[model samples]
Target chain A: MLTLVSRNSPAAPSGNRRRRSIEGGWKQITINRAFLLPAVVVFVFLFIIPLAQGFYWSLTDFTGYNPEANFIGMANYAEILRDPSMLSALAFTVLFAVGTTVIVTCLAIPLAVQLNKVFLGRNFVRSLWFFPAVPSMAILGLVWSYILSPLPSGVLNTTLNNWFGIDAVSWLSDNSLARMSVILVGVWAQVGWHAVLYVAYLQAIPTEYYEVAKIDGASARQQFFSITLPLLTPAMVISSFLLLTGGLKVFELPYTLTNGGPGFATNTITQALITSGVSQGRYGLASALAVMFTIVVAIVGFSQLKVTTMISRRFS
Target chain B: MKSRALRVLALAAGASLTFAVAGCGSGGADDGTTTVSFLSWTGQEQMEPMIEAFQEANPDVRIEASYAPPVAEYIQTLQTRVLSGTAPDVFVVAAENKTNLIQSGAVVDLTGEPFMEGVQSFNLDTYGSDGAQYGLSLSSWAAGYAYNEDMLAEVGYDGIPETWDEFLTMLQKLKDAGHTPFLESVDQMPTTVSAMLGAQTAQMDPAMDELIFSGESTFAEQWTPILEDYNQLYTEDLVSSDVVALDGDQVRDEFANERVAVINAGPWIINAVEEANPDLNWSFAQVPGRDGGMPFQAGAAAPGYAISANADEETQAAAKTFLTWLASEDGVQMFHEATNDVTVTDNFQPEVNPVFEPLVEPIREGELYLPMISWQRDEDRLNIEVVAQIQRMIQGAVSPEQVASALDSQLSGS
Candidate 1:
């Protein structure tokens, strides 16, 4: 997907070859640079400007309506540190991110490997697994709320009652259960998409290496651990990085499912940020929360990437 | 390779050029007619007819109407526009954004405006500060307990009792009769609690908020009894603790199916209840009172229409004409018929739905009580915390005193 060879093509020359090649290389670099100006302009206007404005707002008592705001120093940040709800949200956010990353990765890799094997209706099974990722998270959340409703008349509850005589379970009521329900739904929605990514990488691995391993009397498990696992490191690096970042910034699944309810059991940082910044008029404080949230997510996400990259490098 | 690179650069430049061209707004018409831009908080189904009526009445003013659904999306959309000085000439002033709009001087004061004549004082005062009105509110909504008549009859209770103790007895009787008595969605402030607080505040000289906000009293002292009374439903097992997970819609469905005898609801659910089961017999009642105090309904003044302060004189005049027509007798009647909202204007006595007749008196007299609407400051933040803490109380994790104290802390912090 990424092409570097044509850009790095050496200039063909005979006399005064070194100077000609240097000039040609410089020209190619200039052409490549010309193609990047649009992206640079977009990044500056869209990302950097708003980010700078947020940082500025974070340092003031800007109530979001008034253009004229007082410079309140670090008062908003200090308030955030002392607010128990923000701290609770922070805890849940970390738990959700770590839980979803671990669960989705553990499930997706195995499912991807199984889907890659020759089996009856394998393509159908792959499509079925990938269907959950097709619809928007908000819709899935609404449907799952009905399925996991605490009422006896709820879909899943009725089924369990009829088939097994089980009483209705309070899936989204108890605090810990609500958190687990949100995470479980989140993992269910995401694992299949990551599995699809792994499948693409699986197809790219050469069959000759597996054939050689098989001829050497390597069992199927050995083939997976030795040959297949190492080769899938690149995909693992990409998948886990996406998972870590996406999991940290999640808002919709929990928002539509439980709405950060049962006493803030499923509340995440983004939900708290949006509530403060937009729903509530505390834009200055919301901006401060946003600034701190971005930094923490960056730290967690980058550290995760570095560690995963190192582990994948060992496998490579 | 060079040609391919040039093509890629050309594509990027072309895309940016297109975006720049599209970003510029369309200019006003050359026609003499004044076009007043409006942002509606109501859904299009209800707003379109009203806009049509306004346009028909005043041909000089052409309303360009747009809508963002309440509460979050509308707030965010209007907030950005107001902040950027591109707000519509007319928009709905909702509880979520009213504080910002009023404080930012984004909306014009309409206290003594000619258009505000015959409008309900309570509606105007809800959106106003210190006797200066900013929004022309036309209607108010009341939420109380919707009871199944059959269920009440089965329990030998003709109606919801007046006293809290009697109400508890009726709930116990319903439970003994093998019917789920009550289910209130804990996603927001429970209606029963809001009504009791309203009854108490109605009796106060300076209002409950005035006493609390001015530091003469605290929520812990004012709201503890109400919270304790509300929590009794959960404590005594008259209501399910699983209600912490149920929303208004789910509870409404349970009521519709007769699975629950009563559900805390508002006029918003009437259509849904009827559509789900037209054969079901249901009626609304003021939430029962504590001790001998008169029963009260939990409600608020509906969101009102406000003109932008930034609009030019001619546009503002045109917008005023629209607002005037919207608050007139015909406009209020049309609004009530279209949306089933109880009209609050003095000039218009609306015909409410038969099922919601019990709510008509309170809506007309402006006896609604919504804490977020009446609170002097930090309404949304306090509401989020209050709802969460109340849910915790419902789940037996926190006491009623703790719920009230949480509000006190939230008020102090804000």
Candidate 2:
């Protein structure tokens, strides 16, 4: 850390009393060198190293289990293009990612707006919403499985039968329904987190904009569209990007909920990767899959950032 | 240009190699004692007594234990450790990681260990490949219906049926008298496949599995009749597909609550029932087989110990000594008394749950199996696919034939 920090700091005005080189000395160099070196080392080590490794592995047969690997060229990339399970996982994953991101963003904005306003039991409600994220998803999944099981004896079905005379609902067993149920649970788990993010950013947007709009006879909805949405763009970008990446990498919730069952209805790419790679001892194939997955994720993530930034620019 | 570049390149390569070597040199030989780090796949309760006994017997050797909650977490934790080159000296090589553990050379072969003397042949074969033992298995666990005698008497049956047909007829009688006939945990592997195959494997020759996988026969050819026989529970509307959702603990609770007449279970579950409802009129029976077949069980040797491939000669010798002691008469008895498992050694036997007496002979005589542990390769994948297919079959999606064909395709592809 010390070595990294001292190599790229900004020049200090009069620290260099000694001059080894006549033109410019180590003192001036060290002053500027100190600050930038830390960032450079961190940036290189944490991001660049892993990214480079992933890219290199994508071009080879690096099964995660084995030490020795061979260059397989683009066979991994070509295989991913044809694999059906990977494609299905991708489709459902995108549906889940996009659906949760949009729904959570819309719901959270209003939720944050309302939450910020003083209410009789605002703190209590805040805790209730945020508590979904507290319990491990695995436990919550088991609880929800009992609640949504497709049999008459299931908890939800029994309640519905006595109260409303409705039959059982198979939330996870059916294909389309399982896809939708996963997205709903994803939204339920994350809305509070994104809402809190919005709440933080909401405090920063000047209250004067709303007050000035009211004086100009602008309606509440108009004021929100013109003033609030523009200022909230950066937060929106940050939250949705988080949702995108996190959603793509999710393994536990779907795994616990359905174990990628009803014939791969709720399977995720990560689950497939772990299943095929670690469990099946196809490490080289799994590594190839992982490297390719990392690339696709990076590509999608950066493009989304660019699109969001452009949209933010338009709104502002 | 070449001379100037060469000078800088040489310095850079030297510096990088120095850094790499420094990281590699961090691990070296320990002091006198060999520190064996093990991952206990079983939870603390089941493992504590055996571990304590092992520790008491070998005070010089120290064993550090970590745990993952169950199957999934155990596999993941081990994978992470093995990948990072930090796996335990002695850990479980259960059915879950049998293939990968052997395939990648993650576990050491126990072909000539002294501890294996007089150990059950079933235990050896369960963890072995090509007739070479890799694990020193301690006990076998069989799962079947834990029947309530009162309920069967309510439906007018003195004991478990001998044939698959009669078992269904008994379940029919129970349902006719307003009893929930059964509950099985599809979330965990059910004993249905075990009972169906376990018996056949015991009677058949060793060359059979190789022939079956070589496309000489099919699972449908053998198992369709069993599934059709078992499907009577669902076809007759005696049990529900609700089981596809519930796990062992929930099903156990149902049995505890006395709402259900039967539950698919193992000896591991005896304590839960004893604690929950002591007065319940329950006893286990082997699953009824096709054409009055020999009663078979879905069971295997519990996780066995393995020496680390990375250990030095002295540590390896010390580990071998520990393993030999563990299999000794005193050690086996201590382990069995603590675990209450039906150990297969002829040297010692611990008094276990009273209901287990009927099963002790078969377990010790090596007449049980676990399907995942019995496969030649891709055991985990095949098990997962089979369970999912069974779930689908119950849900009315695929037939028994399709399930078998799917497995054959998977086998062919790999």
Q: What is the TM-score of each candidate against the true structure?
A: 0.93, 0.85
Please give, for every candidate in the order listed, the TM-score of chain B alone compared with the true chain B.
Answer: 0.92, 0.87
- Candidate 1 lDDT by residue in tens digits, A64-120: 777898899999999999988898888889898889888998899889999999999
DockQ of each: 0.67, 0.28
Which tens-of-lDDT digit does each residue in B69-118 have in candidate 2? 75666777777777678776666777877766776787788997768978
- Interface RMSD in Å per candidate, to 1 decimal? 0.8, 2.6
What tens digits encode model 1's per-residue C-alpha lDDT throughout B29-117? 45767878888998999989989988888887888888999989999888888889888999999888888889889999988887687
lDDT of the candidates, in the order given:
0.88, 0.76
The most accurate candidate by TM-score is 1
Candidate 2 local accuracy as lDDT?
Answer: 0.76
TM-score of model number 1: 0.93
